[model samples]
Target: MEDFEILDFLELQQEQQGIDKTARFLQKQIQNGFKISIVIKKQHKFALAPLQQKKNDLFSKQHQPMDVTSQSSEQTENNDKQGSSTSSHSSVKMNKKLIIPPTQNETPEQNNNEQKSEKSDDDQISLYSKKNCSFEHLLKDNLLSQKIQTGLSFMKDGNQKMALEKMMDAYREGNEKLKQCQDQQQISVLIIICIQSLCYASQLLMDFGQFSESQKCLDKCLNQFEINDFDLKCKIYITKAQCNLLNNQYLQCLDNYNKALIQYEQINWRLEVAKLLVKISFVYALLNDFTDAKKICYEGLQILQSKLSHTDPRIYDTYYTLGCIYYLEKDYDFALEYLNQSKEGFIKLYGEQHLSIIRILNLQGVINHLQGNSIDAMELYEQIVCLYGDSQNIGLALVLNNLALVYLDRMKFKSAKLSFDKATAILKVYLNEQHPTFKRVEKNKKLFVAATLSYL
Candidate 1:
């Protein structure tokens, strides 16, 4: 009987040890699988740390209070079900499903709750996708947006140089995603600002006689203007007209000017209408139709004189146009009178060194030379040369070339040869070989040189 009792106690101890070992093994497996699931879900929400923390808090609150006895009972029930439903060979299949670990033996309600938790995590991640990304990527996008904004600000304030620099940097560095976002947000204003800056840059290039570059800028500006920006469209058309005029595409320029004028008329933009009239007059002059040029000039003058004050900028343009018209018709006395009035008006509005003032001075010198006032013409020419400093400059070259004619007419053969040589050298450097001005200068130089030799 004693031996039997001892054997029974030994059997009980061994069975208890086996149960404890099985429970521990199952608990470890469940904990490991729970940890892996948490990690995988955490990775999906990498950008939303606050949401992950909330999930962890919810999990702790639900699971932390369970006692070991209840955990053990749950484990035992799961183990029984698993052992009955799965064979040793089916363990691999069971592992593949990644079902809730046997130690937990979750109910249907608990499974549904887990699914809801996962769905919530996915929804949260999708909602804050932009905020959750890598800090480096986020910071880079922010910097690019800030740069674009700065560029737009500079453009708004009329600082075109700085605006262009910043805008170009943003355009180069910005990613496709950022561009898409900007488009979706209707941030076309930034693009418009960049286009406007390019237009201003083109204007500066035109001033320096860079016609090809200026045309390219105008093309880009026109491409960027949408149907909604009627004002910008009208302005771009006007600019294209001016560029066409500069490139000697007279008919095309007139067509563009007419189109712009029609748009301005529709918009009731009188200032723009007046400006277009001046451009039309220029085209007429280029066509050598002095009658039409004078007619346009008088029409513009009537509108400006009646509607605008003497201090207005349009007044000077009107006076200058009248002077050019009279000069073209060989009315030298009236030309000089109108040109002097234009010059005084421009000097009052803009300083003496302004381009308008310089151009008027050049025209005045030509009119004086035509009127046989050689002394006055020579003095004006000398003043222009001194102000411009370089005979090769466009404004100065025009004056120098005209002054050479004055000397030739006076029969000052040596002085004429010297002036012709200077003008030819400047023209050769500044004007294209095929340019009319260049050919004229060459012809005049040859005549002056031949005259000088004959006189000698």
Candidate 2:
């Protein structure tokens, strides 16, 4: 025990000598005014150093460096870590050096330059997103317009099936609620889609002679309509007017036309006014008021002559209306004269195959039949029927009714019944059993039955 204590005392004295030597060295350095400047060489710009680098920084100190054996072991451990950690961290910042503390000449705010650079990058990203979004919206609107145009072209070419498919594709999107829209642009898009869909659907229904369904679509369109859109408003009212005319609702037809006319005149649209005049005169002619009908027809013709050329469509429309009025008055010669004039004008404006001439051909056929020119009338009716094929065209159906009457007069009961059946089938697709056109065909069918019975 005594030998162990003497050895411990010798060890304690050696440790004290070492402590005194380090203190004496530090005091000499301070008295000589030593300035310690840490000049760090950098390889990467990062807020945090790698594990090996941190170890090197912590262990390597002034007047005492890590021994070579310890350094080699640390390097071996860092190599092992590199293989496992490189893949995990290679995606982060590896090209720029770490941000360091500010120097004596630098302001505190200068250290925040990295953060400001990051913020600017974020703003550029946001601006690019907004530009892309605006471009997409433009493409969306143009695509919509193109589809609507394609639908309109199909309608004009009389391809109802293709037209329906095109319209459905154009219409059935963007159904978000207008109230839920966050901006005026969103609300406008919804309103445009609604109006285009409803208007095209209603007009297509009207062309198919489905007046009730057409009216329903038109009613919905009115809810989305803007009051300042007089052109579209006039179109809707005219469609309504035509529906009433076909259904034999003369008073309602007049009311609809008057509504449209009021707006046209308010806008001082003379072209539309002149056209409406011709149509309104026919309504009067249908009521057997020949004097007022002729008066209105001439008034419209004079306005048209002043505004349009001799070959203008409105001029031909005026002539057709006059022919119709004179026909109702049983002035067959005058009716034929005006109808021939209108037919030639229309043939010049639209090609011979165009349906624009159908109404004129029909009037001429009726006049020929009344004048005992059954052959001419038969040719006219057959021509119109051939033009439309077997489509459910209301005009073609009416022509078939007139053709059947010609057959009845000539004692061709079988032919008359065939024509009557075709007309009835077409009208039934469009009109109810009680509609005037349907009833007309039904009433004529009795003649076919009676004649057949008498012959048998």
Scored by Cα lDDT, where does model 1 land?
0.49
Best by TM-score: 2
Give the distance in Å from residue 90's predicted Cα in candidate 2 to where it truly belongs: 56
TM-score of 2: 0.60
Give the least accurate 10-residue stretch of model 1, judged by summed lDDT.
Answer: 1-10
For candidate 1, give the lDDT of residue 413.
Answer: 58
Per-residue lDDT of 1-456 in model 1, one digit per residue for the tens?
Answer: 000000010111121111111010000012212110100011011224543343243223412222323322332111111111222121101113211111111111223112221222112101112222343244335655567567657645545457657755654443233344433222332343344345555654454445677777777655533323344456567777776665656566777777766655553444445566666775565455566576565555554454457677667767777777666556778877988898898888887776557667767765665455767877777677677664244345545665666665555656756766776565554445655445655655665555445444
- Which regions in candidate 1 have their CA more than 4 angstroms from the true location? 1-190, 204-213, 224-227, 288-291, 347-355, 389-392, 411-443
All candidates' lDDT scores?
0.49, 0.54
